[model samples]
Target: MLKDVFVVAATSFVALPALAQTCAFTMECYETEACQDTSFALTAELDDSKLVTDFGDLTVVGVKRDAPLITVFATGEGAEYLLSRNGDTARFTAHSNDGPTAITYLGTCEGEF
Candidate 1:
């Protein structure tokens, strides 16, 4: 019985982080130079260690689990993306690898799984 209790406690502890880090949304991206907005579906998986996305992957630099904001950086491409979620609304910003081409995306959270 003690071992079963430990197993259940450990499983819940390990699963909490994964559950907090998974989210999905659909976003309208506004590109600066293009002068147009495009829509895309994005799913983000952010663990304590790393952040993964559709366009590219980044290392989890910092995260506020309370505010549910994540700051992630690409490995060597000088790119960064910020994801912030508030209720069913989320905002995403992707910085370009070039000089000053940043894209801002406004999105609604589809669901979290």
Candidate 2:
């Protein structure tokens, strides 16, 4: 019985890598919310749960699954953001330094997580 359970568990873990995916998000900054002015294309590592942008690499702090929408929360040195995706379309928002300024990111995803 123990051997059978181990085999099943090992088989399940083997399939995890196949579920890992990477997504590219576009930064859409508002007039007042200037995220370095030119930093775009934030890469999301779905399997690794990491987001890479002009703020550098940020590890996902939490995740929320709301049916069609899946959201990941991440924080940087002075900024925090959430990336939420429904199918191919995704929306992202970030606030830094605890100020009122916030930046929004919008784009389409290519793979599944």
lDDT of 1 by residue, 1-113 (tens): 99999999888866453544444444455564533455555555544445556665566566665655434343325767777777667777768678756777676664453
What is each predicted model's overall lDDT from 0 to 1?
0.59, 0.73
Q: Could you tell me how far off, in angstroms, the CA of residue 75 lies in candidate 2 after the best superposition? A: 0.6
Model 1 segments more than 4 A misplaced: 1-17, 20-37, 65-76, 110-113
| TM-score for each model | 0.58, 0.69
The per-residue C-alpha lDDT of model 2 at residue 94 equals 82
Q: Give lDDT tens digits, candidate 2, residues 1-113.
A: 99999999888866545443345555576646554433356677756778866658988888888889988899878888888889888777887776666777677666666
State residue 82's C-alpha deviation in candidate 2, in Å.
Answer: 0.6
